[model samples]
Target: MNKMYKVLATASILALAAMPVAANAQQLPAQAVQKGNANKQTDVKNVPATWGQITNFVHDKSDKFITVTGRGLAPTDQDEIVLAITPKTKFIDAKGKTVPLQKIIDGHKTVKAFYSPNITKSIPARGTALTLVVQDQSFSAIDGKVTEVRDGRILVKGTDVYDKHDEEIWLHFADKATIIDQNRKTIAAGDIKEGMSVRAFYGPAVAMSLPPQSGTNYVIVNTNMEDVNPGEVNELTAGTAGVITDQKDGQITVIGQPLEKGGVNYVVLSIDDKTQIVDEDGNKLTKDALKTSGHVEATYGAVMTLMYPAHTHADKIVVKKAESVKIEGTVMPSDRTSKDQVYVNVGSDDSTANDVILNISKETTIIPALGGDTALRAGTKIVAFHSPVMTKSLPGITSAEVVIVTSDKDAVQPK
Candidate 1:
């Protein structure tokens, strides 16, 4: 059985290599595509090759050998192959961030491997993988007021978004980092001051110290405030992830869980013309869309009024897609009439009671619980995992992640 499977897998890879458009596969990861056959036992021919997205990574009961199965040899339906994982296999994420082999084995995440052109024995059936890469397209952001800026580095004092603890961090800018305004316009990093609210997107690398030292890939400096009150600055600089409760007349009420409180907390944002607004995909949003779009990630200053609920000026707002919801049931997929949004029924039977309209982003991930593409259609059983906030409409609005489409309809689906 193993020999037959190996033969089929080899043919699949060769067929993909012979395709007219195999060059596109090189974009899978930054350093994932490399060269060198190195030795006689490793080459399938003189020409080099690459392959990935292996899902099935299993070890023998006695822990001797392991097998890995993956699809889309070149992002094609005909591409399917398996690789043997030995101790020599190195595991990492798309950004070349090293990941543990045990984590890949335990989680239901996509595993991509690249064989350095020399893993074959005469034929291309299989060989020891050179490097294995895991799935990681998400980012971590830190929002706070700039405490200090010097020597091409910015120090921020704010709540850690990951742990929600009061903390401070020194951020070093990447060589190619972009320092922009809410409008994403280029600006001088030196213009940032101590009291201005700012946000920075960084990587997993961090130095262990009193206030962790790290670096940022991009930074957004909020010039909204010149100075923040010490007592109120914590609330001003703290980031909030929530759902839009009400929006009208340049005011947006977002109800999200507070860092200190477990229950939902509400904050009404006073929007001004200069307020930086954008969508989850970082697309600039108009004033109208900023209000109506229910889910958001926002940063603000102290409340301006003494009203019952109180209000504050939202320095920066991201009308984000709702995250964290396990949607399950038969799908009653609405047709793609226009390009706005799609409403798919995951409600009871065929009712719209539990159905939701989704604003899908290009960064969204869709895969089967068991792997490969599961065709989506009317009444297709599926389970979707998303995050943080959810709209309160009669049905609601949301975004999807890892949607397990049950039907074996199409071999190829959108990434």
Candidate 2:
């Protein structure tokens, strides 16, 4: 029975190789199939040839093999063919250049393999590879901001031609991967930083994972921040000041007052080696300084995910000092003792309610919700950063350091 099965399998492989182009037209590239057939006729001389995408490659000290699927065959595990590589196997690249085996495996390019006619009856038949030709060596480009940089890898968040949505991809740099700056000068991988704009060139083969993984070939850093006009928003700039709600897994969750009436109120800031974490006194600190319920001002890249509580790569994070506290609530009607004084209700429930009066002095920084200076009024939502110490009066009062108007209903247009 085994001998009969081998004969049948051999006959099936031969018939499929000789079959018309229409049978495997979609699976194999036209140029690859034509060249494969020509090689069978001239070089191999009656040896059967099969072409497909390299699904798996195994290379050790002296053992090397590749699994492929195509040539009128289904892509199922049972239909894959394992081709063993030996010293006699010739490797040819897309440009007809004679290349090494490592180059073909590194690119993970689709290939046409000429093999011996004798076949085994194993689930996935095995054979000796004669000549392998790389079908495509075309490179793909990804333009985005670097979110993370690790040992020999960098995570980029951006879009490609095939995917319009935001994609976070981890690019594994090949040993020979070239890194260059804007002037085209070669640089080390250490120069790549979080929030920096870069374009990476990689191969088509991608490993299936949550965030897809690919082998990168070349990288170009776009480092020209001085050219941007002051106050102009671009792909390289984004800022938010809010309270830290969570800090874990190298990310900080900041819950700030909404930018507009119904805008986003939270942002996830991803930190990397280049992210500067400091205190308001200009003293440098580690990421551990970002504690929950603490106020912070973060500057990150404009490239961010569109999901709720958007995520971005942070460039700098300024942690508010321990002496300060942030209060967020609705403004309440109260008779002010002076023009710089305002009152706010500090809690939703009656049991926790506290009427706090904020003294906005000339030294206070008032930022309006809609981008310009606007006076705070009743029923307005505000986030005020002030000293924790307050006067022990009916309505607790303190000097406001920074008051952000978060409501638009009472916001007046700036002149």
Q: What is the C-alpha lDDT of each candidate?
A: 0.52, 0.62
Residue 406, candidate 2: C-alpha displacement in angstroms: 7.2
- Clashes in predicted model 2: 0
Candidate with the greatest lDDT versus the true structure: 2
Model 2 off-target regions past 4 Å? 1-267, 272-288, 293-299, 305-310, 316-323, 348-353, 361-375, 381-384, 401-415
Clashing residue pair totals per candidate (backbone < 3 A): 7, 0
Candidate 1: tens digits of C-alpha lDDT, residues 1-415: 0001111232232232122211123333333323565443422322222332333444666332234432223322112233555577677877778888777666644555555332311111234456666755322345688888877777788754433466577777665555767555678777777788886655344444445555564566768666646776545464456656557887886655443311114467788987888987888987777643256777765433322133678777887665356566655545532253445666446476777765655534343322223345444566555453568985676665435455534323346
TM-score of each: 0.30, 0.32
Q: What is the C-alpha RMSD of each candidate to the true structure, in Å?
A: 19.1, 23.5
Q: Worst 10-residue stretch by lDDT in candidate 1?
A: 1-10
